[model samples]
Target: MTWQRPASVPVGQVWSRFKGRERDGQPAKMSNWERYIAQGVSLACFTETDGAPDELVAFNITLDLVDVFTLYGVDRYLTSSGLTVLPEHRGQNIGARLFEARKPLCAALGIQCTATVFTATASQVLASKCGYTQLAELSYSHMAARGVDLSGCATPTAKLMGTKFHFD
Candidate 1:
């Protein structure tokens, strides 16, 4: 299926539905969602119809300011951060599809690096499968400023840097 980047607000709503709780354990604030979507540089994924009883599968692409500055001397680099598929949609290639769709955009943007922090084993596996290498295992507190949960989540981040492009 073809993928497109929705406006950040709508993408945030989709993100909120999958992420469930905020770091504070409260229902996620709309502002946080808005922030994430706004911070996201690009997106490649599909959204299911509202009230369709189906899962919405999508991959969110973001640019990390810090990493971009450190590695590329810029404040932006492509990142595939949020990959969510409804339970029923598991085993399908939705995630891969999202990645494939986003790859070209990254290339066009001259994005030679990508980074992401993952808390789930499945996410780690997916990252490796998608050609990202485990670069660091750091404390979640490092990501706290981003509104992520430090205590409950184990932060595993991966990266694909330099002039390498692998789209599968």
Candidate 2:
């Protein structure tokens, strides 16, 4: 099923839910969720309501990425950073559907979409499966030197991926 985000959901509600959940035996930190929301990025969570016991299984957070676009000497680009799904709800295609929802959004906004897939995360596979082209691959050590923490990540490298519907 495609992603379904309720209009009434709140970030705090989801943050609480992810707090005690484990990804690779490491419980997801509430700080991560808070930082994602505090960045003032747009966020959406996927709710599986097609059957009984509807639930929030996944989420996607997008930013305008104006700064990055400027660095590239262009504009009209979006960057999606938080692509998360509950561990218990994974392998059900929730991540793919959430990622797919961005296609129409990009078309409507006339912007290209980009995101990153970290090693050992389902996002690496999900990004490819959702038709995002691999743009670059950077090792964790390189990212760490840039002041970004990679301790929690399981992958050796993080891949940047992109999808576009317009040339200009």
What do the candidate models score in CA lDDT, each in turn?
A: 0.50, 0.57
Winning model by lDDT: 2
TM-score of each model, paired residue for residue:
0.53, 0.62
Error of 2 at 53 (Å): 12
For candidate 2, write residues 1-168 as lDDT tens digits. 322233343333322111222234422333345455453434445333353323444567775554454433456566766677767656656566666666655554456655554465567777777777777888889878899888788778888777665544
Please give the lDDT score at residue 53 for candidate 2: 23
Query: What TM-score does prediction 1 earn?
Result: 0.53
Q: Could you tell me the TM-score of candidate 2?
A: 0.62
Q: What clash pairs does model 2 have?
A: 119-155
| 1-168 per-residue lDDT for model 1 (tens digits) | 323343422333222222221122222112233355555445533433574423224445465343443644545555655666555445666665555545565555545556666667777777677766666675556656578665664434333322245545
